[model samples]
Target: MDARITKAEAALLLPATTIPSRRLAEVEAIRLAAIAARDEAVADGVRRAGQAMLNAAEALVRALVTFPARIDTYRALRRLSDRELRDIGMTRFDIPRVFDPSFATRAANDSPQAPQRAA
Candidate 1:
């Protein structure tokens, strides 16, 4: 009796096992751990972004609500013509709208007046 085998034939006859079952188990564990870590990181980022956006919105609401007088002052100043502002014991230079926006609008609305700028 004589037996002969080619490398190609041997390879074809061998059972395919790219990874041993134990190693496959380890690889699957690692993959699952990595996926879990990635999910946690993504969730944390979303939570932080949501919190920051909420903070900014709250601040905007407070600014608009608390500073109504200041906004009104600006409107009052705007209503005055450049020439008129110059005449009424005020001036574009003296009470520059940029420096004190609240003054112009203080009297225009029924809203409570802010403390007047001391003369």
Candidate 2:
């Protein structure tokens, strides 16, 4: 017994109402089903590619060693302009937190150009 069975093989197991014509119809049905499955797999591959990029970015942010290296990595991620990164997911400022915890905290609290904003 062949371990692998295709849609056409499964259809062949069924009793044919019209003997000769049934084989041709079953083959066409299996071919169409195979094409649909292939297209779905292609679409899934593209989706996984995009998700891999986001996972890489997140990992890069988490693996910064020094301040300068962190800054460079943050800039690269920022260049993507992905809103998911901007909205508390990840940001350039998170880079400084590794080197200067206070600086990161203060920046989060204080507004840049505070005096200008007052005027």
Candidate 3:
């Protein structure tokens, strides 16, 4: 047997080396694709979180901007007499409950003094 390989032998061996290299390239491609997918998921999560924070901030700003108007309305309502309040389906006691979410329901259910409007 010869110690040196001929060109024909080297050519035949080339495919053997290339097969493993091709497999390595395919594995690298799959790994890169997985990494890209993970990064995209993380980016989407961050975007959603940022959007949620922005929505909360907008709501807070809206509340702050409307606070003085709400206070003014409360004061105006407070200045009304019992007759005026009754006509409007409210009472001096109901003034503090104006900001409560259940105020309308509670008022409708509870206030016997609330005048019935003509149909």
> Which one wins by TM-score: 1 or 2?
1
Measured over all alpha carbons after superposition, the RMSD of each candidate to the real structure, in angstroms, is 10.1, 14.7, 6.7
> How many clashing residue pairs are found in candidate 2?
0
Point out where model 2 deviates above 4 Å. Answer: 1-20, 61-119
- Model 1 misses residue 100 by how many Å? 14
Which tens-of-lDDT digit does each residue in 9-79 have in candidate 2? 98999787546787888897999999999999999999999999999988687765455786776666656
| Candidate 1, 1-119: lDDT as tens digits | 65998898988887756536988778889999999999999999999999999999998997888687766776787788866764454554444444455654554322232234568
- The top-ranked prediction according to lDDT is 3
lDDT of 3 by residue, 1-119 (tens): 86999999878877553565878888889999999999999999999999999999999999999999999999999899988887777778889989877885664435866545589
> Which residue window of length 10 is worst by lDDT in model 3?
107-116
Q: Any residue pairs clashing in model 2, and if so which?
A: none
Error of 2 at 41 (Å): 1.6
> Worst ten-residue run, lDDT, model 2?
108-117
Clashes within 3 Å, all models in order? 4, 0, 0
Relative to the true structure, candidate 1 reaches a TM of 0.44
Candidate 1 worst ten-residue window by lDDT = 107-116
